[model samples]
Target: MGKKDVSISDSIYDRIKERVEGTGFDSVDEYVEYVLREVVEEEEEEEEPYTEEDEEKVKERLRALGYMD
Candidate 1:
């Protein structure tokens, strides 16, 4: 994919630059991509919605495994 130009605040940009130096990432794009991946994974985790049937299945499994009262 072609690169995109982005503008960020000086403080946030400095922090990304500092982290990139320790992480061996040579460019702002690379560091931003890594941070974006982390954010996406976190969002995916938050978006996992459990239905009523899913909760029931978990309760049954826990009972079968003797983890429930």
Candidate 2:
């Protein structure tokens, strides 16, 4: 895959540099890529469409809480 350049504040870069010291990451770019990939994976996982059973459960909860008739 082709790589592109991204800019971040010096302070953030310094923080990441310090955090990666004594760890497996060789550079700030690798650490940032790993973290961003993890976050994106989590977001994708949460994007699953709600099912009819899921909607019914939410409605039932609302009824129990007196938010619905």
Would you estimate the TM-scores of all the predictions? 0.50, 0.65
Q: For every model in order, what is the number of clashing pairs?
A: 0, 0
Each candidate: what lDDT? 0.73, 0.81
Task: Say which candidate scores most in TM-score.
Answer: 2
Q: What are the per-residue Cα lDDT tens digits for candidate 1 across 20-44?
A: 6644567877879866876797688
Runs in model 2 lying further than 4 Å from the true structure:
47-69
By TM-score, how accurate is candidate 1?
0.50
Give every collision pair in model 2: none
Look at candidate 1 and tell me the lDDT of residue 49.
Answer: 72
- lDDT, candidate 2, 22-60, per-residue tens: 666788899899879867976887868768998798788
